[model samples]
Target: MTDSPEEPNPYTAGLEHKPQRDDTFYYTTVVFLVEGTLFRVPRHPFIDGSDVFRQMFQLPVPDGVEADGCSDGRPLRLEFIQQNDFKQLLKVLFPHHSQPQKSSPKTFAEWRSVLKLSSMWEFESVKKLAVDHIGTMQIDPIDKIGLARDYDVQEWLVPALNELAKRKEPIGMKDADKLGMELALKVAAVRESVMSSYSGYPLQIGERQAGHIDFTNAIETMLTTLENS
Candidate 1:
């Protein structure tokens, strides 16, 4: 009699692996690999705050694809992002305090990470919160300008540039490197104009008026002109 075809090994057969439900959490857990570190966080807050995550979760899973969990299950992989940045972002998204804390990020660096990830993921509220916190920090004017421009924080841009313009010392090579050559040159020019025109004039405060030399307006105009030119 013909030898019966070798039966397929049950263990070898392609099967959707599911991890044991190990955690006693109230909500479903979604796992992410950030910079090779595994973070198993709750799904609700991410889904609620991030349009990107919401869309991702709404997508139909492919046939035989296991849901995201641990290795026994499928852990969602987020590549090319630092684990610390992701951790900071999660802190903002899921704060430890039941009520809003007076202090969010203790440092500018932490807020920067939150801003980067929140903006990338289109977490608008979180982005706004990060921006607000960043606004209060004592950051270098050049760095602040960069962050403002990058994140489209319009309110931050004029003030930061004006602060740079008002500085007694001209933009150094290091700061110029941060602001790029074009912006650095523009800032230098504005500083010269402000020094010459106003002499000892204090930095303009409040909203721009019709004819007054408003540093904010000047910065805004300079930026507009640069963009157009």
Candidate 2:
């Protein structure tokens, strides 16, 4: 047996060659307690992906006081967080490297959760991934508007607004509640303007309003102006 080929990546062979720290390969495990559940994961993702985590990690530990994530007794306690949401985030941040697709978030709600947490924690990469995934699917326009506002999803904003402006149905009470009084009134105003202009006829789905394609641009400009106000 050709002596089991050097088991794996060998370390610096000679003593004279002092071992150097490899930043590229460094990893530390951290434990977090979410909703009374313990989750131990590689610390690098948290430290690297989120400004919040990076700042938390950089804070110096007091003499003789163990870091919160160092042990079970003092694991980082994340508050106001749903354990399922945290788990969904972990599925993105700490995937099953060997079988990545196995741990991939597939459902629309799953991606939304990832987007929410990633945005909240300032994980730009994960946030982008969530945004892209959501882009591929259809979402309720009112909900999308709320998401765009809460997460600063600039691209989703105009498109969702355009959908709302161009759709046939008037905003319902529940949807109006979601959109808030100001925006609901603005949308109603837009629908009224378009309908009244079209000789008492409602705009059909996928039809250019009054045979003018500039309707979306008009809606976007109006909404942007209102939002900024």
Candidate 3:
């Protein structure tokens, strides 16, 4: 009989790494949740399986979005999901509310404008609209800050600042301190932009009137928050 070649050992050679079920993976699906609900979503690009549902699958996270956050609620996160989920969320959020005013055609900027107006009026339904759909709103800190300034929404302004502050250390920006300083400068710039439109005076001269001092204080406070946090 011919001698058989020795078989390769399985223990230390020819070992293959198998990904666990919880490995980060992507899936494209219709994403139907409750009865009679459907979400239009693009194919998944990338997302962490560990925090998929809690972090990445949110309505506002644009596709292929990335951010830093744990499975638990933390500072900042970057993530994406389908547009359908976003729309479904809005429907559920404002079931009893009036439909937003129709613009000539739908555009992302239009959507932002609508939200800005709604947020300013403090209409219960409009607030609900933002609440329901803000999760799906793909906005960066600069844009959030700018929009809040342009629209004069005090409520949304500081929170966005704080959110960015909380995440600054984790965002891996080119220079954290410099980034904070730049953001402070941006606050100053926004104050300048809004000053041209300043109307309220004295007693009401605050976020509603492009008050530079207030914006400066807010930016400073955010920097402090990030430093300590």
lDDT of 2 by residue, 1-229 (tens): 5566554335755567667778878678899999999998889999889998999999999999999999888899999999989988998987875266658788989999999999999999999999999988888888899999899999998778778776666677887789888888777676666543345665543343433323575677777889699
Q: Rank the candidates by TM-score, best first.
A: 2, 1, 3
- Best by the lDDT measure: 2
Summarize candidate 3's per-residue lDDT along 1-229 as a digit string, tens digits. 9999988767657557633354335434333232333433322322221233434446475566533232222322222433443343344333343265521214445456445534543334544454445435666765666666665555566766645443313333433343455566554444433333233644322233332333445565645665576
Which of the two candidates, 1 or 2, achieves a greater TM-score against the reference? 2
TM-score, cand. 1 vs. native: 0.75
Top of the candidates by TM-score:
2
Clash count, predicted structure 2: 0
TM-score of each predicted structure versus truth: 0.75, 0.81, 0.27
Clashes of each: 1, 0, 6
Candidate 3: where are CA atoms >4 Å away? 1-110, 117-124, 166-183, 186-229
What does the lDDT come to for candidate 1?
Answer: 0.76
Better of 1 and 2 by lDDT: 2
Better of 2 and 3 by TM-score: 2
Local lDDT at 95 for model 3:
38
Local distance difference test, each candidate: 0.76, 0.82, 0.44
Question: Which run of 10 residues does model 1 get worst, by summed lDDT?
Answer: 203-212
